[model samples]
Target: MSEALPQHLHSAAYFGEQRDFWWNHDYVALLARRLALDAVIDALDVGCGVGHWGRVLLPHMPRATLIGVDRERAWVAEAAARAAPFAPRATYRVGDASALPFDDASFDLVTCQTVLIHVPDVPAVLREMMRVLRPGGLLLAAEPNNLADAMNVGSARHLAPVDDRLAVVRLQMVCERGKIALGEGDNSVGEVLPGLVAAAGFAEVTCWLSDRAQMLVAPYAAPDQAAMRDDALTHYDNGHCIWSRDDTLRYYLAGGGLADGFERAWSLARDAQRADVEALRAGTYHTAGGGVQHVVAARRPQR
Candidate 1:
């Protein structure tokens, strides 16, 4: 599995861009507040993709330590790259979510973000998280869902190159913002986190919903809409295939079947992209872009 993770992450566009965004943004700082990091001296971020949070937490935790674990090595590499700037203050390694590589009572806090939905055994993963933290340690989890709205699909061929181009543009923009690309995995957060965390024997847990997405594109403004469209398609195709075993990701990437179905639909994608951009420019998409943020927090029993 370790040998394969690198290919999955590097070739997989989904993680690549997310790592870029995490490294570039303050998303980690925002995450720590939910975890109450000021009180946590050491933290283990389970399934810490690309380890962006480590950099943010290192400075905030003062003399504390931070470690990140992930199934994907390239992501670990990306996380390492981001953490390198922070030096000995932070470190990350390739580790399994189902069975973490750590000793009992190894950490003061265990954090995982949006990882429950992706793993095969949620309870097992939670148990592993619980096992590593000292008694009274904090458990912080935030997993967001991917709900799609105002989305349209169209063929990449037949229509004028501009229209085919626009179809890819809208798909990429909407999916990226929703983090729909990251996936809800297979189940809803409402159904997954509470039951799993409770079963792991956490005494207390808190939940939160967040909605924060803001991006739009009008195809007409792009100088080479065609080139941009191809890039978007390639990225969407590559990313979709890597993280998901779902045939849909592989199907679109394959490209043979979709062209037949959406030949007439290309124009609709352009229309969708144009309308969304216009609404965004007119300040009409405020309600449309945001979605719920689900956060689950737990406190371990006092030792």
Candidate 2:
């Protein structure tokens, strides 16, 4: 069985509770082996949210001294506390991603998961990661083309009416464009990170797809399925879509969604998610909503 989702405080309400359903051990092990992760002596997890990425990767790199940094003090404290059981020497600090608080060439591995999508200046963040990484150090990031994932309508098992699925997809596309246009951040940064990494002077840039899949089948026996149900419940309780309704609305309006269309689009999307939850309860729901996250890795130049 996979590890339970950490019960740590999350800074973002929408994604606060979701966990290892996507970034499981097998996937991390693959990345570790492919990238020679065991060779890393010092690894820095930038924007480490409760140290989930570190927790998943550290066991594979036994010699690594893990360092987790997040802007949220709560996350920093939680990461430190959680890592104490096995990684006693691990450290956690409050810091920014674009301006990492670390010395040049301080670590053999500098990485982040799902963090770059939220940063406006992704190149700056990559440059900082490069700066802190030692010669021949690895810079790895797991980001997603979130818009593509959002457009996956899933099989008929999850969709109540297939016709309306396209509408929801279009709505999401609009919101994504709006989100980017607002100078907030690009939600689809994963697809473009290879270029960004190469542009940042990193060599041997490569990308891989995360092997973990978020397929939810009937009876909901798996821990992942249970977690999904719980997540949907949380979203419902908070009156949020997969992303928060407030944030989605802002993005939608920014993406050129007419004020008049907001209610209809939101209603359709919310009802669809609600249907999915109901299907789960009825033991009829199934979906492969697992995002295709891009693991973009590159090596810093030898100094």
Candidate 3:
């Protein structure tokens, strides 16, 4: 029998409408110019979840044809369906990032968004991406230091006790360490991606911070804000944060957190979540939203 997929594999919570606001079109256009995408005709998107990253980049590459690959068959199907509008110019298939099913030097551009963080061996995936990219081809990756979000101060938590806030940060830090230890990948892998790309033998490496901020203020009327609010509410209603309670507990235990302290940590987190939700409902919730996504770009050395 086939092994069951991970619980987070096909989660709608992540691929929801809020993803559309990830990049500002003008910012993408600026990146396109900087990367000289005008000369790129064939591009590959590895770990292309629902093809969002590819779709976002396609408009900026007027002559490019996109081929997206994902390990999950369901995401491949969804990506293919989502690429319908670009039919002849875009395609999706089931493939792993670490072992991409394509020939060497096949694409002029190879990229992924929030993909490296989930792979057990980021370097292996980078090698594969470089292998499929033509000499002189561009390799772009977007990953984030997600752990930083734990330190963000929201209106609801502004007056929270320092110890309580520290507990939240401690919980996230432990979970991140455990996640990496368990081979589940790093949640904040973006901080070192530039060095990784350079070490992987890619030349002329460069990095930039994503301009979009997920700021949610009173009224929550903007489409993106509304989506964010709804997503949070759904997760809160389900009694979890981004990851389910079970997943968090597993990570905590793996990361060296004592079993006895799990309940207290979890309870603190739940209380914070509840406070945020109540504040949102009362039109009093807001945050500076210092999300830390990094975009790293490099090129395969010309042979």
Candidate 4:
């Protein structure tokens, strides 16, 4: 029911899709450290893929137990392998956040990172987090603030929406034929998360900003790839003809050969960001980073 993993909804475990850095980024690490997770053990990550976040967290909590859970069995297997060194200390499981198979008060820290947007039911997931967490446990939920600066639209106003490269124009024409889940909120899932966390009944809701852009060159900066990676880039290199230049062409031709096609225009927007990679990191590229995460924490209404 949740939207298919928006960040990399297209594919998963596709040779380390988002985990190519995913939650294992340096900034995310610093952010996690700032969260002071060391105070608690037996933490769980819903929607954990490849168990990469543990790379940063486990080392931080050498003495605490950590577990990563996901709906994908294959990813769970990979996550298990990644966390094997920790073994009993760290565990991986194939589970759904909406229906976790854990007993009440099973975890002292329950964390969800950029996982809610992909999911359809935010409240259901929040309740589940509460269900598994101990009475006084911490619920650490992190998502992007795509619409964080909604009022800043006028302040940072630029040129009117004229078709500059004819790319956007063409893409719009193509979109008329098929469904493209387009919306300011849709484009960037994490933009306005503070309000959502508040609504979720999370208290002590503290928020922080995270900048996750790679600054320059390959991976994060290389313009077109979903994100960056050392070995995860083979997908783009080998499938360039199939998914790159040719991929856009296929979408266009399939849509009556509209020169200004949707895929092509979207690619243009990515290209535009690459040109100003600085801006991309400067909070221009919403959704991924450059915003505040409410990271709300609340109790289960102790009785």
Candidate 5:
């Protein structure tokens, strides 16, 4: 039999094509301007999974040479391959976020996307990112308040009983807390980043919301809509909602949820997922897609 695939730090399902549409080109360009990326000559992408985040930043910072680091050797190899087109200007290495490999004051910019959510000690990672960033260099992080996204009302689930909806929300909330309690990191860490950055002694801290949304409507013909539909269907086929049932159960239990209560909540959530897929198949599903992703930016204080 073929050797089993090595398990990386995060779920394999998360690193998919859907991530490609997470931001709009124009919005990223705007962010580049707002962050003064033109001045950057050396950049570091912490926890750079497959180099996606670093690739996204390249076009906006023509003067920068990008370096990507990840704890997973597999991801580093893949990132290196993906960054081949950029050659000498881009490189990837296996490194930890809490203790980056580079020297202090090494980079003109330090950034990460959806990375902090997976780190158990966000502050430690922030300090490491800051250490390698030169004085006056930019530090940018993109993260999401996933709890809000979980609570969004889609057309298919709008008519769910209030009690049922509330149960699902409670399940997610408790699981988020449980994840943190278990040192798995926070699912909704985006909302607190600005405060954390300020407390970390960064200067000119600021935050912005991503302009991209995952709206899906009938026919689902749009490229993004099709990607969304495929993502939903993939989850349904895999017999889980956003996370695998086993993982959800572990988090729920860790968060102080009763075993019996999890059964009901999980059932409700699974039913909702099924309903979404069915609605999508019938071309009747729709949602405004108000996801809450925050882009937090700060500059290392000048000496």
Candidate 6:
């Protein structure tokens, strides 16, 4: 959903820190509107890392009782603590996506953000969510096609050759392929979820693009921009140029990237990202990075 995750990945350090830049309040409202929150009573948030998505959607559904589930106990604890102030009726528990620890036909709404993209058997997870949904209950999954992020257009400090751009793209493709080949989840699962939802026999399947973008301008006074600045700096400190360089390299090599070309490709991509960061510091950076992020919603058929 948010990032492509390998099966072997365990650390939750980076996931817990990202916020405000991508899934902003306006975009959350857009998604909540699409879900049509008129009758939701009990809702489930799958893979709720730190409950960001649940918190964002909570204000829109005043009557809804939220229960968040994650595989990590630490995240569950963090989610509960973070949500306690505003979401009194909310609860968090450690659970897995393929086997939610809930009764069938229990929830009025079942949702996830960027969760399905990390699943190994996406259809199985969808079926499981549907099974737990009350008849006609809504199912919403927000996911992104991250390969688009690799070639995302933005104002660059230097004009590089087309070939250089192509090399970066190629490098990304290799890394993505490697991530999946190594049994890691797909980072670009958003583009495929509509069909998956329909195939699972959910009725009235629909999709909408997230209205969010990586828009940054001079002075960067907007609240979202300020959040983005903080997020970018945090990412830089964590050595993440898209995904972390360490993770990307592991996937790249697993996906069959030549050992010899890794340095040049990685250097080029990092330099490009660093250039944007420098421009941001100088108050001259402007970019609107778009990706194939989709909020696909469907409903279980009434019994």
Provide TM-scores for the models: 0.63, 0.91, 0.95, 0.63, 0.95, 0.90
For model 4, the stretches where C-alpha displacement exceeds 4 angstroms are: 1-34, 145-187, 217-303
Clashing pairs in 2: 178-255
Q: What is the lDDT of candidate 5?
A: 0.87
Model 3 lDDT per residue over 1-303, tens place: 113324367444577668888898899999999999877899999999888999999888889999999988878888888888888789999998888999999999999999888888999999999999999999999999998778886889988999999998899999998889999899899999999999999999999999988899989999989988887787799777757899899999999999999999999888888999999889899986778999999999998
| Candidate 5 or 3, higher lDDT | 3
- Position 30, candidate 1: lDDT: 65
**Candidate 4, 1-303: lDDT as tens digits:** 122333233224243444444343566557557767667778888887766655556766656788888888766776777677778887888898889989988988888666775565677788888888887777766665433422121211234244543444444344322211221112134555556666767666666654543232323444323453322234434333113454445444555655654455657644433433433345343232223443444444454
Off by over 4 Å in 1: 1-7, 16-35, 148-187, 215-246, 249-288
Best by the lDDT measure: 3
Q: How well does model 6 score by local distance difference test?
A: 0.81
Model 5 agreement with the true structure over 1-303: per-residue lDDT tens digits:
113324434656676667778899999999999888988999999999888888888988899999999988878887788788888889999899999999999998999998898889999999998899999999999999999987896998898899878888888998999899889889899989999999988999999999988888888888888888887898789876767888899999999999988888899888888888899899988998888999999999998
Which of 4 and 6 is ahead in lDDT? Answer: 6
Worst 10 residues of 1 by lDDT: 149-158
- What lDDT score is found at residue 166 in candidate 1? 58
Q: Where is model 4 poorest over a 10-residue stretch in terms of lDDT?
A: 178-187
Report the Cα lDDT for residue 105, model 2: 92
Task: Show model 6 residue runs off by greater than 4 Å.
Answer: 1-18, 21-34, 157-159
